[model samples]
Target: MAHTPELSPSQPSGSLHRMTAPALQPTETGTGTRQTQLLARMLLTPAVALLFIWMIVPLALTIYFSLLRYNLLDSESAQFVGFENFRYFLTDPAFLASLQNTLVLVGSVLGLTILLGIPLALLLDQPVIGRNIVRLMVIAPFFVMPTVSALIWKNLLMHPVSGLFAWIAKLFGAPPIDWFNDIPLFAIILIVSWQWLPFATLILLTALQSLDEEQKEAAEMDGAGALSTFIYITLPHLARPITVVILIETIFLLTVFAEIFVTTGGGPGLQTTNIAFLIYSQALIQYDVGGASAGGLVAVVIANIVAFFLVRIVGRNLEA
Candidate 1:
């Protein structure tokens, strides 16, 4: 064995202390905070810069095109026409009809989903056999492609002559109802609600599962009725999740294209054309790029307005 080196009084006694002393000593708090902040900013810079570019480029292009008298049919005649495109797009007779249809479609679907989702979520939350299978079945519709779902509804379910609904009606001595022909907007709403119902149910169920069991137990122990417990405890717990669902669903619903496309084709007349379909018609059908861009900007503004109100609701719920 090698002889151990003798410690010197003038130097540190132990290698461990020599190694760890500097590290273990308190760092300057201000210096550490500044270092942490700098590192965070450096890490965040790339993501922030990427997001900025992504949002800014499209917005800038849209603004630029919206101000021009650009048409795919007459590309050589393109000229800057400060808001003339916007004025024309807004003043179009189809604009009012499409706006009304959009409002109706969005409102009806939101109401139906929320009304149906809560009961479904509560039902699924209870103890039952094959609960997992039931949940998977319920959620399966949301995973189906929008176009496929629309076609399924159109041909298999809502078809006046040869559909399941028609068969059901015939069985009960009732005449088959032509869903799209009689109630086109409602038919669209029904299909959209079916597709979105699963999403709302999943979100609400998760919220239900996260509920504090002890509070529920306490409520029961205090002689609270089922309705009372739900009204007070369950409903309050669900407020935030409901707001989240509404916000997310509204954003997607604002741009619903596929279902309308595959089913009604935006009409028997212009009856089913929402703002999105109107914009599509302007750009692709009518070959008016400037008009479409202006319509797109209007859509953005409407979405932002709705989002602002929904955010306020969510914020209040969070605070409470």
Candidate 2:
């Protein structure tokens, strides 16, 4: 009783898809690239909007408030005084000290990390027993929270009376040196360098692993000594990574705050105070919003300047 449907065995298997292909065409004008670009823009719109709200809006507010004499403690309304906050912040002697401390901290940590990380990375790269365990132990420091690490270094390690260093000093019949009190800036640098050293090592080690083995073997066959191989081949290979480490580390190092805040409290009388701590003192301790905002803007400008130069350097290295 049913009418038999004719089998179309000669027809292409994708015949249905071919018939429906026109329906799947993008509504947007132009070719595949245009549609893809439109889709990408649509996907990115939310992220772009969120970024503008999060970063740009606050920055604009900071700029606006920087122009006003706004003290959080003062009951009086904010009064507009263009460039006065900037002038005051610049003239304040603390700013100079903070600037110098910032530079020193960044420079010292960078130097320490690079100097130590290179050798550490080389050692880690070599085939050895428990190499994986050694790497894990070495990288463990980086995972520790900055505040926690500062506390550990301060109370457990550096404490003059009841700490590990004090015990070691006593064993050697040398009087224990007070770390934070005697050399506050150095203590901060040490703490920060400890935190960042693993990052440098990890990056350099990864770069080292990607190095061509044949080249090193060839160099050795040609009578290149270990030091010579390092100088001629390894160091040159590491140049780009080193620049990258410097650039990235410098950016975050410019805002070194937590270690100083936790360990030194920017103290023994401003010895460890950097730009970031100075801003915190202004905003929170002194309760001068305008001054803090101005300082913040100054920090922004300095960071931009540093980044500009760093980017130029990195671009040249990349080209090379």
Candidate 3:
């Protein structure tokens, strides 16, 4: 300044002082951020890798096989057919029938499960003695293997001559019905529902338990009847869980095979045949790999469509 009073060597010029030493390296924060990113990637890698492998491998194989006229019985005869199998399946009467049966089976089970599950959940939510024991009993069916459940219903509960149904019919002086023959689809539906009802009940019951009791009390204070409070408050709270249950159950129901396989084998006349059973029959019994792969792809498409709508509906409800 005025001959800038001789600045000490220790005092730098203003420009030199203003110039920052390449910002002191934030070693700790930088290292921590890098380490955190690495740890997250390491943790997520396995699941991502597994899903990638699982999806890509089978899906690639299915697509490849769908284009070829492959037969399990005669590999040498394999040739590229490119959508012929899909065309055949689309036009096949048996395939169409199986699709119908699949829809019916899924619809029937879904309707019955929701109807029964909501009530069962409501009852289980009550402060009754041994409620936990009852809840366990209700969920027991879901724990049973599908094949075992089907067998139990077929042999012990629905068998015409010696089953419980027969015994009960006899007691009432009524004829024993051949459930598998007269209403084969209905029999399969019942078995599937019995197995899935427990799942629905468990989910809905958990949702019911988490409901806000203060809301119920407030409604009660407002002179709302029990029915009115449940309809307005409890039902709204349960809608999400119910949607989840239905979506998950539909996925399982669409691929239902073991119960139908063990119970009626998709017969008396393909009356209970579903897409899964149809795919099995095409691949194994007929040894038609191409057809089976096409059917499998179709099934996957239908399932995805249903899932898409269900997810969208549930997401909208959640946002609301």
Candidate 4:
């Protein structure tokens, strides 16, 4: 073979350069990493932008309308009113009643769901022949729309004459209680509780299943009874999930509108009117846009306050 020409000292051979140059590799890697980061940001931009617009636009408009003396029918009266709308909304005679009803409804539903859900969850978590079917049946109510559920309960179940509840009452020699007439708030609560019970049951059942078997075994070996084991081990395990359930339910319950609209129409003298229904009546029924916007803001603030307190409590529980 012909002797290879001597490589110049200033210029390294290709193989040598390729083998010895590690610095170039990092620059190329950095470029690729930067490109990946840029692409990731680009991909996320649209969703983030959409979310921001979706949340901010309505909030801004609500605030703007709340500050003006705007009525749907009277365009000439659309002038700045500062906090006057808020004063008017707050001073409305029905506001206090609505606020109280809203709180009672949310609190009662949470209590019932938690109390009933734990037992239901424990029952469902046990080994059964048709466990999947049972779970589906338990969770089926939550899938029903609020309007549809309200209608069913209002007509088929609590009709006070030919409804299922009335028939059951008659069979038991009890008078058929008119649910929406005599006890409108209770009727609303019952309807809402029925809808939410399934959600609570599902959440609690999932949490219950996540309990560590070894801990239970140890407790059993130490002569712990089922009740004691549940009080200690199971309840502690379910704390976080229960908090999550309560928080989520509270937020939605604060704004319950559809059921009241379909069933009571905030009627029987505003007995079943929560904050949401009150706002709806103001805006759509009364056509007082400014007052309704103010009420909506108030409801938002109340919800934020409740959520803040709940989050703080949950944080403490989580830390423990």
Per-residue C-alpha lDDT of model 3 across residues 192-262, encoded as one tens digit per residue: 89998999989998999888889999999999999999899999999889888888889878999888878
Residue 210, candidate 4: Cα error in Å is: 0.8
In order of appearance, the predictions have TM-scores of 0.85, 0.87, 0.88, 0.88
Using lDDT as the measure, name the better of candidate 1 and candidate 3.
1
lDDT of 4 at 172: 98
- Considering summed lDDT, which 10 consecutive residues are worst modelled in model 2? 1-10
Mark the regions of model 4 whose C-alpha exceeds 4 Å error after superposition: 1-24, 309-320
What is the model-wide C-alpha lDDT for candidate 2?
0.90
Residue pairs clashing in model 3 are none
Residue-wise C-alpha lDDT for candidate 1, range 204-291, written one tens digit per residue: 9999999999999999999999999999999999998998898889999999999998888889788899999999988999899999
Of the candidates numbered 1 and 2, which has the greater TM-score value? 2
Q: On lDDT, who's better, 3 or 4?
A: 4
> lDDT of each prediction vs. the true structure?
0.91, 0.90, 0.88, 0.90
Q: CA shift at 141, candidate 4, in angstroms?
A: 0.5
Can you write out model 4's per-residue Cα lDDT over 105-204, one digit (the tens) per residue? 9999999999999999999988989999998999999999999999999999999998999999999999999999999999999999999999999999
**Candidate 2's residue-wise lDDT over 104-204, tens digit each?**
99999999999999999999999989999999999999999889999999999999999999999999999998999998898788888999999999999
